[model samples]
Target: MAAVGGLADDRALLGRTSTAERVSDILRTRIAEGFFPPGTRLSEDSIGGALGVSRNTLREAFRLLTHERLLEHQLNRGVFVRVLTVEDVEDIYRARRLVECAVVRGLGAPPFALDGIAGAVADGLRAAAEKKWKGVSTANIHFHRELVALAGSARMDELMRTVFAELRLAFHVVDDPRGLHQPYLERNQRILDTLRKGDAAHAERLLADYLQDSLAGLLEVYRRRVGADG
Candidate 1:
C-alpha cells in the first residue's frame, strides 16, 4: 500500500530473470523495511505489473511469505501484511534472546570483528541526529543482524532475516516510533561497548536484559492497542 506504482523502472529485473522466490524476497524486505506496513492489502496486479512478474509467480511468493507468517491470505479478501498479536511479539523476543544471547556468549577471542556492529551503531546515531525514527529502528535491526553474523553461520543469518522481518511487523503497529526505539539507541551502544571490551558474558547479559525490557515495553503498548480495538 505504500506506493508500489513506481516500480516501472524495476522492469530491468524481469529482463534479467525473475522468479517467485525473488519476488517474495523483495516483498519480504520491503515489509521488513517498513515500506508496506502491517495490515496493508497487497495488490497482486499492481505488484506483478510493477515487478514485471507473472501473476502465478507473484502468488507463489505470497504463498511462501504466508507460510513464513509474514503475510496472511484471507478468503477472497486478498493478502495482507500480518498484524502481530502480543503472543507473536513475545515469541519473537524469545527467539531473539535464545539466538542473540548465545551469539554474544560464544565469542571466540578478543578483537572480535566489531566493524559491522560499530557501523550499525554509528548509523543509529546519525539517524537519531536526523530525527529519522524509522532509520533508527532499521539501524537497530542491522546491529542485531551483525551480532548474529558473529556466529558465522549462513543458516543462522537466513533464519534471523525472517525473524527480524516478523519483528518489523510488530514495529509498524506502534504510533510513537521514537518512544519505542529511542531508548534502545543507548542500549545498543552499551552492548557494543561491552563486546568491544572482549567481555562476552557481560555482553550476553546486556543483550538478554535488553530483550527482556524491550518485550515488556512492546507488550504493554500492543495490549492496549488490541484491547482498545476489541
Candidate 2:
C-alpha cells in the first residue's frame, strides 16, 4: 500500500508539471503557428478542460502569455489573443529596423552563427518552394531571430520575441502566409550574403528596406481581409 501510494504521488507530480508545461507550449505554438486567431477569446475553463488541466493551472499559463503580450487581459471580460492593428504592425517594423539594423552594424565581422542563419534561410526558401507557408514563416522568423541573437543581448532578444509574436498574430489574421512571406526568402538570402561578406552597413540598409517592404505588403493584405470580413 505504501509503495502504491508513493507511485501515485509521483504520478500526480509528473502530471502537474506536464500540464503546466504543455499548457504553456500549446498556447505559444498555436499563437505562433496561427491556429488561435487574433481577437479570439480564450476561456480558462474551456481550455483547461480541453487540455485536461485545472483552471488554476490554465490561469498560470495565461499569466505567462499575457506577460509575453501574446494574450491581453480585460478588466473583467477575460483574456483574448492579441490583435495587431495597422499601427501595431508599423510600430513593430519600425522597432525591428532600429534594433536589427543596430545588431548587424555592431557585428564587425560575421559570427560563426552566420552558418546557422544561412541554414535557416535555405530552409525557408525550400519551404516556400514546396508551398509550405507555415514552415516558411517559421523559418523566416528563425532567420531574423538568429540574427538578433548574434548581438548577444538578452534584453534585445526578449524584445524581439514580443515583436515576433505580434507579427505572427498579424500573419494569422492576414491568412496568406505564402503571399506574405514567400516572396522574401531570396531577400533574406541576399541579406545573409551581405553579412557574410562582412558588409555590416550594407546588410543594415538591406534589412531596413526588406522590413519596410514586407510590412507594407502584409498591411495591404490585412486591410483587404478586414474589409472582406466586415
Candidate 3:
C-alpha cells in the first residue's frame, strides 16, 4: 500500500484532455518512469483523489492500461503494475531485434540523419561520465527511441514508446543500475561508430547481437526476481 509520489505535479499538468485518457497517460508515464514500481498496489481512492478524477473516470483509465498489459486487476486485490516475466523479456527483445535492426539496416538507403542518434549517444556518454546511472538508463531509453525514429513513421514512434515503457518495467527489477547500464554505454557508442562508417550490414549485425546478449542477461535477472509469476 505504499503510494508513489509525483502524481500531484502530473495531475496539475493533466489539463484539457478527456479525463480518462489523461489519467491513463499520466499513470502510464509514471509506470514507464518507474514511479510506480512493479507489484505496487494502486488504490482507486488514493489515485482518484490525487488526480481529481471521479472513480468512474479512474476506473476507465485503469481498464485502458489493463488492456495495454501495463496493469492487471486481481479478483479482490485491486490493480497492480504488471511485473514482466522472463518470457516477456524474451518476447520484448525479439520485437526489438526485428524493429531496431531493421531501422538500422535501412540506414543510408534513404539516408536517415544521425543527428538524433548522435545526440542520444552523447547524452549517454555525458551521463556515464557524471556517474549518473539513472541518467545513463534514461539516455539508453532515449537512444533506442531515436533509433526507432529513423523510420519516420508516427505510428512506429508511438508503438516503440509503448514498447519501451513496458520494457522499463522489466528494467526496474535490476538492482544495480550502473552494472546494468555501464557496459551498454560503450556498446551504444560502438554501434553509433559502426553506423558512421556507413556499413549498415555490420551495424545491423552488431545491434542484433547486442540485443541477444541483453535479452539473456535480463532474463536471468527477471527469473531471480519475478520468476514465472508474471
The candidate maximizing lDDT is 1
The local lDDT score (0 to 100) that residue 189 gets in candidate 1 is 96
The collision pairs in model 2 are none
What's the lDDT of the predicted structure labeled candidate 1? Answer: 0.89
Where model 1 places Cα greater than 4 Å from the true spot, the runs are 1-18, 228-230
lDDT of 2 by residue, 1-230 (tens): 88887786587667666677679878998888777888889987778878888887788788888887788898889899988677777788988988888888788654436877988998998887788899998999999999999888999998998789778888888766777888889899999888877888888899988988988898788887754232
Q: Runs in model 2 with CA error above 4 Å?
A: 1-22, 110-112, 227-230
TM match of model 3 to true structure: 0.88
Order of models, best TM-score first: 1, 3, 2
Listed per model in order, the count of residue pairs whose N, CA or C atoms clash below 3 Å is 0, 0, 0
> Which stretches of model 3 miss by more than 4 angstroms?
1-17, 108-111
C-alpha lDDT score of every prediction, in listed order: 0.89, 0.83, 0.85
Report the Cα lDDT for residue 174, model 2: 70
lDDT, candidate 3, at 15 = 49
Assess every candidate by TM-score.
Answer: 0.89, 0.84, 0.88
Model 1 error, position 7 (Å): 34
